[model samples]
Target chain A: MKGPRLTEIVAGLPAIVPFVGPETQERQRGRPFRARLGANENVFGPSPAAVEAMARAARDAWMYGDPECHDLRAAIASQHGVAPENVLVGEGIDGILGLAVRLVVAPGDPVVTSLGGYPTLNYHVAGHGGRLVQVPYRDDHEDPEALVAAAWEHGARLVYLANPDNPMGTWHDAATIGRMIAELPEDVLFLLDEAYVEFAPAGAVPAIDISDPRVLRLRTFSKAHGMAGARIGYALGAADVIAAFDRIRNHFGVSRIAQAGALAALGDRASLDRVVKEVAAARDAIARIARQNGLTPVPSATNFVAIDCGGDGDFARRVLAELIARDIFVRMPSVAPLDRCIRISCGRAEDLELLARALPDALAAARA
Target chain B: MKGPRLTEIVAGLPAIVPFVGPETQERQRGRPFRARLGANENVFGPSPAAVEAMARAARDAWMYGDPECHDLRAAIASQHGVAPENVLVGEGIDGILGLAVRLVVAPGDPVVTSLGGYPTLNYHVAGHGGRLVQVPYRDDHEDPEALVAAAWEHGARLVYLANPDNPMGTWHDAATIGRMIAELPEDVLFLLDEAYVEFAPAGAVPAIDISDPRVLRLRTFSKAHGMAGARIGYALGAADVIAAFDRIRNHFGVSRIAQAGALAALGDRASLDRVVKEVAAARDAIARIARQNGLTPVPSATNFVAIDCGGDGDFARRVLAELIARDIFVRMPSVAPLDRCIRISCGRAEDLELLARALPDALAAARA
Candidate 1:
């Protein structure tokens, strides 16, 4: 018997989740991980004020949240030094990426990104039937020059680049990024994912004209603000491009609790400063631990550090497997050069202690 | 020089929001509504257990929610006596609706629904470039027979029918709905949006096999569970249809706090029973209040009652405006015969008392 048919685009797509969450791993192993340092989640947690705000909002969860995300957008706009019309708040960076892709890419349209860059963005692109042209990273960092060249080659309408790039925690300074922005093809839309920018050094995020319609800046509270579970993120772009999201976004997608929590967290500069300093210490400790284990740790501009496993991708894979078996959750990149290193998130001392204890044994086991 | 181009379809569709929320109205008026009986929200609020669970989850908002939605989906499966694979949870009914449409609708594909049924349903169809074929309601209820016939005529891939219908608060019995289902063409997928099913009568929902690929059922915690702001909803469909959602859905779209709140809300059956009973009482009270004000209250199975304003659609519109001016936030349908009535949601005594006190004045102002 015939049933309703799936659109050819969706039918052609494979059902896959870009990231395998740590919880799924725990379920398979029948136990919790000893150190939850994967997924770049902040271990220190959101501010007490943010938590309190969420609790307060929980009592009033009967009414639907403001579809316009009024107060939250106003606050975000003020912080960004742009008009509220220039901002678009959504479920998270993931949701905003999906909408951005939907707005610009049609079937058979070309889209470009680094080969092993954020898989979620690639997923959104592929889900929309966009042809993906993946350029390999240069010098272990997402190469802006290569991305621009690929976009021009493919006549790509979209290109995704993350500042303080994931998996390898590398970054380009503001002046370097400014030159990249200036060099971008006028017809291409740059999807600038700055999800980890808060942890990067000052000026890693180049100042770009918000009125310029070519680039969309994506930022999330999930990283430095320590509220990943809340799924709060926003996009800053030209007012018209921002307005385009209104045409297709699930307007009430953000939970009221998330809105209130993000708003509160944004106001708590002290908490942000504390988390940044704590993350820095944790990063340094992680580097020292890597050196003690005879692995070279890559200098990081984000909350996570990538450690060169002193071997190939396969060897790094084995090391990751050993870590997982020992209940120390860590992840590595999905592609060649980047995959030669295993990435670990900055964690509290207790969590790092677990990681430290497990690493030597994990390394021995992987070698065997 | 051109800067980023929008795809033809997105560029072509009108940028519009399906509903103007009451918050927007409040902002425009520069004052809050004294009585918020609009939007069909359960003003009594979520259970204490749910609020507590959400508050607890707030502390752990640093980690992302499980992409699989494991425990929450299992809990929902247990409640429905279906396998977890049969259920797909999303941001809300609106979110689920959008995904469902995206899966089945290609550009210019035909979809059938009642005229002025659910604007959001139409919005999703339009967003996905689906051609909407609207059949007029049969005697103020969603005309399933007409919808099916239209689907067959249009060779529609999808049909949306909201049982315990919105705007009119009317529904067909199980036997009638079963006939509607039986008559559906094999190629047409029936989208049964049972958002208000909890408030519907015992036999209002027809028995349909869970294995049936011909239909998918949507439900929400927004109404009976009083968690609209939490944004929790689910769809039960054939395994394949449910599985298809995985290919394109935002895996981590639902927030962890929402997941916790929904799980706790589902376990609190006492709260559900209490709310159902309270809603029924409120419906009766609304009818009595309508009679007291010399208006006709339509028989309701849903949480809200539709009051016939004793004149035309324009009269009803004027009365609704007057109620708004008096700070009584109530809504009326947007289309012809349906617009001849104003809808009032279930509210606590204080809220309804505000409505009760304001109705006569609103009506008098309308007449004057």
Candidate 2:
């Protein structure tokens, strides 16, 4: 018997994840990875205060969390120097992206982004039937000027850009991004994803004008605060744009413990500072390992480093596979040129040591 | 300035929540709720093992949750004697409902349900631009025959039914629902939301056929498992129907801590049995309190009792307001006949005592 039909937009899409999760890989291998250097998760973990907060809040899991997310939003608003109405919090940045895309994009509308940018954003665009107009990265970086030009050419409603972008770990300073934002088309909403901004220099985040309806900036506790599994993120935009999320978001999406943990994590300044220092050290260690193995490490402004394999995308893919086979989890971009390098997240000493020892064997195997 | 244009359907809708949460009420009142007996949350709490599980998982908040939900799905399927492919877990039943509605009902598509059955389902339908063909309830119970007839008349693609219904706390025997499913329109899909069935009597949940694409059954860890704040739920359907969710769902929506807590809760059958017994006792106590206050308590199959005020809708609404004014959280249905009753959730002895002490004054004040 035939069941209910899917909407044309969703039906046309394939079931795919932006990145294959480490857990899925573990299942396939029938063993857990020794180092989870893929997915770019912070290995340093959340603030101890946050962990204690979640533990303390665990027993009250029977009651539904405040659907409004009032207190956390208030704290976030204060931190960003924006009113609470200018922000909307959701399950994660991924979830917030879905709402952002849905609010502005109609089926078949044009969206602009860099080729081989964050795949999750593209996934959201596809799910909403938004046609993505992709431009190639310039000099291993997302060229804001090229992106703005493409949006104008396509008459796109939305354009996505990540400061201190994923996979490549490259960034543009605040002044350059400000210039880019100024030149962007009036009708296009700039979806500024600052997921890795915490790892960048102080000038990397452009000054945000909350009243500018064309710019929507989203930040998360996931990257810098090291609470990816907690899945808490918020967006800052014009009040009208932010309020649009209420029309479709999961009202009770954020878990109660998550709220408590995030709130506590925000308050723990020492932990944030400590994590940043540790992440810098890990990045340096990964670079050293790359240099010792006769590879070039790309300069990075984020928690992960990209090491050039001195070969093509296919060669890099083999290296990634060999690394996985050696119980060292790593990833590479799906596009050409960029895929000549493998990406590795910052990890603790033990995890980094495992990667350091396994790299030579993985490289040799890949060459063979 | 008009920035990016909203998709036409989303632009036409108003921002709304299915129900105003208790926290929102507290925010308006400028105080904490004294007795949180409004939302039908299990006041007895989840198993200690579940709490411990969440606490332990809190330390590992750096890692993203398993996107496939492999282990949790395996557990749920094992419990129900279904294959893992037949089950799909999500943030909650509310989230799962949104996915279900999006999968089937396109813009302007007709959906069949009871007029005031579940506002959230209607909200989902509206969010997706689906029209609702709401059939009125028959004597405080969902009229399955009427719902099926409406679907057939409208040639609707989706039909929703909440077994051991909420707000009204009523149920239909398995055989009757089975008959209703048999008579449902050939191409129509039935969404069976058995959220409150754990508090229901034997034979209340109909036998589900996993191979039947026409019916998809959703259950939650919120009610019987007492983990609403955890935001965990699962849907059961034909493998293909279940797989359809992979196309659009937030891959890492569920938190790692939440997954651990739910898995532990599912394993604690003794705790579930205890909660069921306690809930029954609380229901009886609420009924007794209603009778003592010169109100008629409707017989209930779930964890709440609806008390008729022996007056019209406005009278019951006032009674609800007076309780809220006293910092006692109780909710009443919004529709006509249903609004003639004030619904109280099964709370602990202390919460119930607060309700008992406040009812007479609320009644008197509402009458005045």
Candidate 3:
């Protein structure tokens, strides 16, 4: 009755999920959320055109998707003014992160990232037996200097950074990032995650030449384009680095309906622009609400606002739990200093109103 | 500006795709196929109810799919009379194959499968640095005896077998397979892919005994339920084996629309029964047409028929090319002996008509 033993590394690993989805919590509570502002999902929704394209595609779901992802890749290449060979579309950035880790990391190879950064990437590195070297955040921002120094110290093959960072919603301007990129060791490949780039300020994202083989930039439709449920994302890199994906990727992993939906979503720039504007207004409203409640709202370059609890991590955790109990779903950071804040996403008017009403009572309960 | 070097194993790997989808071939020829019988897809199409479900879910594509795949897993578990912990929904059997390889295989690890078996599984094993030990088909069927011998000889950590097999459309009955399973080495895991099981004979599948944790059964909506483009599949195994998937799988990889479509497809047994009946008729039609063209069609347990070319691999390849040139899309096995046969999938009357008209000319050209 015994199963075959897993590989030594896999046996040592804990079966941990990076995030406990709200769905799981709802199932535990035996009820659905009245307001869902967690996970940074676009409650503003996808474009009407994209929805129509998906509906049209639904009837023809018998045939397998094009393994090459031809049309979608061509559209992405055109938008970026690059050759199609420079782009590799995957299930999502999360999927691509796994592939990237597989390509470069052998057992015990070193990888570097900010301590409180994207856990999914670190999960992939660990899955592949990579040794992770952590660098602590500085003043609520990813300390690029510390990350570069750690990479060099550990002889790390990979380093990950999110522009317009998550959890804290802070950012470093393009010039600052460019200077940090120059300091990265020649052998250390930079994985620049720009999941929130479309919502960042004009000068926040750098215009680095993608022909630099030392860097791979990841982008997703989940945030700005509002196709999170579609699971479409892409990586842009030098042609050689991008071509390596063909050596091991699940070529037919992206569904046909997803490709159709993402292509249509990309074409609807007006909808994207409108979402960006709405997100900005929502951020301002959230900040005002936080100030009225005597909480400090961190300066945000992304869709979500991180409200400083003006207390310790335990207080922030209690506030998050109280919000969940009130049927208002929100999240908080997982690590030390950053964990002292609660993150709220941009939601529809009704969802925001619910959050607004629930927060004061939730805060009071946490305080009590 | 060179990036970090890929591992020695990955650097030596060729850039090869396990299966070239029909869509890619159509793009290369700059014309669509008159009949898509190459990939064994269910040309009968998915249920209308499933299509409607997907269409309805399309508007809500802005929210990320529940990473837990809660509802679909619950439904599948209920259908199978098992707990939800025993089921893990994935992108497809292809995606699950990759995860299995990651969990069990390490560099230089031995893995066993039939020669010319599911190439995607082989691709994943090689991608993860496993040394593949292949056993040849016996009398046009996978020899479970040889597979077991090879596994023992090489101390293989895993072995893969497809029932109602692809390429050759052959199968071994439950008694024979159960005997093989009983004889298998205790530490060696068996991946029994039942992708086309619904189309198989009633007695072909063995009774489920999940107590034997060394066996993991994979099933898919891609074949019998006619949802290949939806990209939804599931794996059933012991709780420990199933739990391992959570440590590495892309949590939000399956799209919301796809999950909805697959769940609806699973619930519609009447549609599935009708499709099975239609598939049997189509298989018979394909065999009849092959006989009319002076070819010998292999007896099949699944949705496709393989016709022996009465010559070597070269003649079969020429015949396949001629079929493609005539806009009748078909495929053949990649290795020798089996390569002397061409595979054609079950399809509707109109699609079979295209095949019927094209086969004679292709055969004559091959003879010439």
Best candidate (score: DockQ): 3
**Cand 2, B chain, TM:** 0.98
Report residue A216 deviation for candidate 3 (angstroms): 0.9
Candidate 3 residue-wise lDDT, B1-368, digit = tens? 76768877789799655568888888889999988999889989999889999988888888888888999999999998888889999999999999999889988899999998888998999998899998999999999999998988999899999998888999999998898899888987899999999999978898777778888999998999998988999998888889888888888788898899988998999999999999999999999999998899999999999999899999999999999999988988888889999999999999999999999998999788
TM-score of 2: 0.99
Q: Candidate 3 DockQ score? A: 0.79
Window of ten residues with lowest summed lDDT in model 3 chain B: B15-24
lDDT of 2 at A181: 85
Per residue, candidate 3 scores C-alpha lDDT tens digits across A291-359 of 989999999999999999999999999999999999998998899999999999988778888988998
* DockQ of each candidate relative to the true complex: 0.79, 0.77, 0.79
A66 in model 3: Cα distance from truth in Å? 1.1
For candidate 2, what is the DockQ-based docking class? medium
Report iRMS values in order.
1.4, 1.5, 1.3
Model 3: fnat (fraction of native contacts): 0.85
lDDT of each: 0.91, 0.90, 0.90
